[model samples]
Target: MSDLLRRVATPCIGVCSTGIGDDVCRGCKRFCHEVIHWNSYSQEQKRIIDERLDQFLVQVMQDKLHIINAELLAWQLGVQRVRYPAQKDPYIWLFQLLRAGAGQITEPRKYGFVVDSVWRDSSLMELREAIDREFYLLSQAHYERYIGRYMQKEG
Candidate 1:
């Protein structure tokens, strides 16, 4: 479990092509210019983009949660056909990590899925145990990466 919850960095390799109308790259899902000049952007500019990305990510996760909750309701109502909730939406924790900006601007999808899948199957106490373990590990990693970047200034 601890091994499955490790953090990884953003996988962007500078391949960016913003869509024609949306101004966001279909390849990297960021504005093309932001992708092109990511290395050159000031910390302030990067932080702004990161914040917007966080919001977009949260919305994506919220949509998944809604879909999962609706499916759970349907199952409870004795729907004739029900999709596997685990397969349908298994990345909720990843979205939480994105919102929290763990690892200083990265999404460790593999670990996120492992934790989320475990969470979906566990009872309340079991889930809480998993969350506590995963959160403690991940939070420590986040602290190591970002506390010096932001919090130490205040300290």
Candidate 2:
């Protein structure tokens, strides 16, 4: 999703909590400053932000699911019109698929992924919520460890 300048786009989902002074946006889990400066950031900065989010997703997802067919996963996301960054790891697109259309997905295999047997009892929507919760917590912790220290020192 290219923004005005055709650079790397924001991850904003429009449910931003940053305006209310949250250290992290509940929607995309971006630090408030990251959200505020996203459009002004160089492509490299944007890529770093994206990779951080992707790494967090990888942490939370772990072996809970696996992408069996990268092309099929990409195709499914395209077919669903899920907004995801282009040229990223297929797992990023997998997260986008779950975020946008988890409820509509009943069978993981058909979507070119496999839910671990231990997680099979949970629905995709449930897994999506779990992932979102964990991701947000990780982002909040990161802020408190890094950015929050500087903020506290200034104030």
Give per-model TM-scores: 0.34, 0.86
Q: Any idea what lDDT model 1 has? A: 0.41
Q: What TM-score quantifies how close candidate 2 is to the native fold?
A: 0.86
Could you list the CA RMSD of all candidates, in the order they appear?
15.8, 3.1
Clashes of 1: 0
Kindly list the per-residue Cα lDDT of model 1 for residues 1-155, writing each as its tens digit.
24224332232435444445434454334554566687876666765655554444444444332233433333432332323222222333343333333334222232322224424444434433444344334433444464434654776
**Pairs of residues at least 3 apart in sequence or in different chains that clash in candidate 1:** none
Q: What lDDT score goes with residue 145 in model 1? A: 65
Best lDDT goes to which candidate?
2
Q: Where does model 2 exceed 4 Å of error?
A: 1-6
lDDT of 2 by residue, 31-113 (tens): 99999999888888897887898898888876578889888887887888887766667778898889788999988888899
- After superposition of all CA atoms, the RMSD between model 2 and the true structure is 3.1
